[model samples]
Target chain A: MTELKLDQALIKKVISATQNGLPICERPYQRIAEQLGIGEDELIELMQKMLSAGLIRRVGLVPNHYALGYRFNLMTVWDVADQSILALGEKVGQLDFVSHCYQRPRQEPDWHYNLFAMVHGRDEQEVEQQVAQIKQLLGDACRAMTQLNSLKILKKTGLRIRS
Target chain B: MKLSEQDRQLLNRVQQDFPLHPEPFKVLSDQLGVPEQEILDRLRSLEQQNAISRFGAVFNHHRAGASTLAALAIPEHEIEEVAAFVSSFAEVNHNYQREHEFNLWFVVNATDQKGVEKVLNQISATYEYPLLDLPMVKGYHIDLGFPLW
Candidate 1:
C-alpha cells in the first residue's frame, strides 16, 4: 500500500470540504476554489491523488438507514470454514442489502465467529428469520448472534486526517 | 490555506444539511448571494479535490422497511464467486472484506421476515452452504461521513 503524505494545507482543505461542502449550486467546485483562493484544477488534482493513495475511500453519497426505515440493523458473525471464506465474503459483499462487511478477530472462548456482516430489517422477528436461513446454509459450523439497539446513536463519521 | 469570506459562508450553510429543496442550489445561491454557476463550479472542484465526498442523502434501511442484516465467512479462494453470487440479489446491498477470522462479510436487507428468508434461502441453495445471520442487537454509532481533514 502507498503511504498518503498530506500537508497541513491539503488536510485543511479536506476538513473544510467535508465539514462545509459548497452550497448546492451549479458550480460548487468553483465556489470551493474561490474560497480557498486556489485554481479549480489544482484542487481537483490533489483530491485525485488522495483517492489513489487510499486517503479517501470513496466520493459518493451515504444513505441514512434509520430515516429510510431500516430500523432493525444487526451485526452478524459466522465461523466460516477456511476453504470457502473468501468466496463467501465476496458473494455476501455483492449483496445489495448488505451495507458493511468485515473480518474481525474473535474475542475469546465465547466469541468464535470469524466472519462478520451487517443486516437491516423492519423488526427483530424479521431479522431472526433471516438468521435462520443463514444458519441452515452454514449448518453446524455457523453460530449467529443478533444485537439490539439500547441507546441513541452517539456518533457516526469517517476518518479525519489531522491538519 | 486561506479561505475567502464567501467560502466561509458557503461552508457554514452546508455543514449539516445539503438543501432538500427542488432547486437546492438556487436556494443556496439566494442565501449566499453568490451566482448559481459559481456554487456549481465550486462543488465540482471540491469533489475533484477529495475535499467533500459528495452532496447526497443518507438512507436509514430499517426505517425504509428492510428487515434483516447478516454476514458470513467464506474461504479466501472462493470469495470472488460467493461475493458475485450474493451480490446478484437486489436485497443484498454490499459486502466488505475485513482482517479477521470469518474473513468474508456482507449485509442483507429485506422488506420483512419472509423477504430475509427468501434471500437467505436463495444463497444457501445456490452455494450449498449456510449463511450466518448476525443481526445488530444494539447500534452504538453508524455514521459514514467523517471529517475530511
Candidate 2:
C-alpha cells in the first residue's frame, strides 16, 4: 500500500472528484482544484505524489476493448503449484496478450484455480489460440487451467470510492 | 462505431505514456498533430459513446484497499434474483455471469479485510449460497493497459 500521511480529508475529496474523471479540457487540474477549493499546483503535486506512491495507477484514457473491436474476453485461471506460482505469474503477466494478471487465494474442495489472467482478443478463436500459447508457455509448471467466458455482464465498473 | 484512422491512433496511443501536465490534451494533440480542442472533443465523444470507460487513474485495488473475487453457484431460476441482489452492493465493483457451474462471479472491494468479510458473510447468509472468496495474493501485471489495436 502507498504510505499516505497527508491530510486524509483532502485525499478523500480528491478521490470523489476523480470518480467523474478529469475534465476533458486544457486545464482539467485547474477545474478540479477550483471545485475542491485547493490550489492547482498543490493538486497536481499531490496527484504526482499519489502516482509515485502507487495509489493512482495512471492518469490517462482507458479505452473499452469491446468498442475497439476486440470482442472476446476471457478470465483464464490456472491451478499452478503454490511454490512456483509467483515466478510463473510474473512471467505470464509480462505476456503482451495477458492483461490484469494476478495470484489469488484458492477456494478448496470445489475450486483450486489461483492464478488469474484476463485475455482479450478479436474473437473467441483468437482467445482460445492465445490460451494455447499460454499452455505452451507454462509447459510442465501449469497443473490445470480453464477459461471462463462471461455469459452476461451484470455490472462491469471499477471500484467506486464514493463521497 | 466506425473508427477513423485518427480515432484509432488516439485510442492506441493514450493507453501508456499519457502526459501528467495540466493540459494533457495539448500533449496528445501535439502527438496526433492536431489542435488541443480536437483531442478534447474526441475524448468527450469517445466517452459519451462508451468507448472509453474511464479517463483517469486506474488505481491498483489491493494497494488502494482490500478486494476479493467471489462467486456463487445459483440455480438457473435464481440466477437473475441473485445477480440483482449481488449487484445492489456498492462494494461490488464487477459482477458477471460465467459459463461455469460456479456461474456467478463478482469482485467486492472495501477499506479492509474485515469490511470485505462483513459483506461476504451477509451475502452468503442472505442468498443462502456459499461464496468462494478468493482474495488477491499478489499482482503480476503492471497492467500496462491492454493493447487496443
Candidate 3:
C-alpha cells in the first residue's frame, strides 16, 4: 500500500467537494476547481489519489430501491465448503440480480453461516427461486436466515475527512 | 470555472426526486426549461469527473424476496482471498472490509432463508472457518447513498 499524506486543507476540500458533487455542466471539474480556488488539473489529480487510497469508495449514484419497485429485501448468510468457496463465490457474483457480496468473521457459539451474498427479485417467490438456484449450485454446504422486515435504517454515508 | 445559469438550474432539479415516467429526462428538461441535450451532457460530464458512480434502479430485497446480512472474522492474510471468494456468489450484493472484530462483512440477499443458509453452509465447509450469520436483527440505517453537498 502506498503511504498517503492527507493534509487538513486537502481533506476538507475533498469532503466538501464530494458532499457537493460537481454541478451538471460541460466541465464540472472546472467549476469545482473554481469553488476551491485550485487548478482543475490539480484537483483532478487529488481526487484520483484519494480514490486510489480508498479514502473515497466511488463517485456514483445510489438509486432508491423502494422507488424502483424492488420492495422485497433480505440479507442471507451461508457456510460454504472451503475447497470450493472461491469458485462458488465467483459463479454467484456474476449474477446481475446480486448486488453486494463479501465475507465476514463468525461470532462463536451462535454463528454458523460464513459466505454471504445478496439477491433481489420482483417478489418473495422470485427471490426464493433465485435462492433455490444458488442452493442447487452449493448443495448441502449452505445455511441461511432472512430478515422479514427492517426495524430501522440508520445513516448511510461514506467516510468524510474532517478538516 | 464557469457555470451557465442553465447548469445551476439542472443541478438543482436533478438533485431531487426523479420522475418515474418514461423520458424522465425530457420531463425534467421541460420542467426546468432546459434542453434535454444539455441536461444529458452535464450528467455525463459529472460522471466523468467522479461526481456520480452510477444511475440505475435500487432494489428493496425484502419486499421483493428474502435476504440476510452476515459477517465473519477472516484472517488478515486471507482477507482478500475470502472477499474474492464471497464476491463470486451470485446472491451476494455488496461486501466490505470494515474496522471491527468481524472485519470481513458482506450482504447476501436470496429468495428465502433456506437459500441463504445453503450458501453459508457451503462456504463454511469450503473455507474451514466458522461463519457468523449476523442477520440484521434491526436495521438502524439502510440508506447507502449520500447527497453531494
lDDT of 3 at A94: 59
User: How would you encode candidate 1's per-residue C-alpha lDDT over B23-114 as one tens digit per residue?
Assistant: 56777789888877897777565545444534633333443234454445567687678767776666665555544445445566664567
Per-residue lDDT of A1-163 in model 1, one digit per residue for the tens?
4433656466456545654333445545566667777876766566555555644444334333454345676666677665665566655554434555555445455355666566666678876776665556556444454442322232233322223
Model 1: CA > 4 A from native: A1-12, A19-22, A124-126, A129-151, B1-149
- TM-score of the candidate numbered 3? 0.50
Screening candidate 2 with a backbone cut-off below 3 angstroms (N, C-alpha, C), the clashing residue pairs are none
The candidate that wins on TM-score is: 2
Considering just chain B, what TM-score does every model have? 0.70, 0.90, 0.77
lDDT (C-alpha) at residue B139 in model 2: 86
For model 3 chain B, the run of ten residues with the poorest summed lDDT: B140-149
DockQ of each: 0.05, 0.73, 0.06
Model 3 reaches an interface RMSD of: 14.3
Superior candidate under DockQ, 1 versus 2 = 2
- What overall lDDT goes with each candidate model? 0.53, 0.83, 0.56
Docking class of 2: medium
Task: Summarize candidate 2's per-residue lDDT along A38-154 as a digit string, tens digits.
Answer: 988899888887778877787777788788777788999999988888788888898888878989888788899988999989888989898998888887888999989999999
Clashes per candidate, residues 3 or more apart or on different chains: 104, 0, 107
lDDT of 3 by residue, B62-115 (tens): 433356666667787887777778877766766666654566656676657887
A123, model 2: CA deviation in Å? 1.0
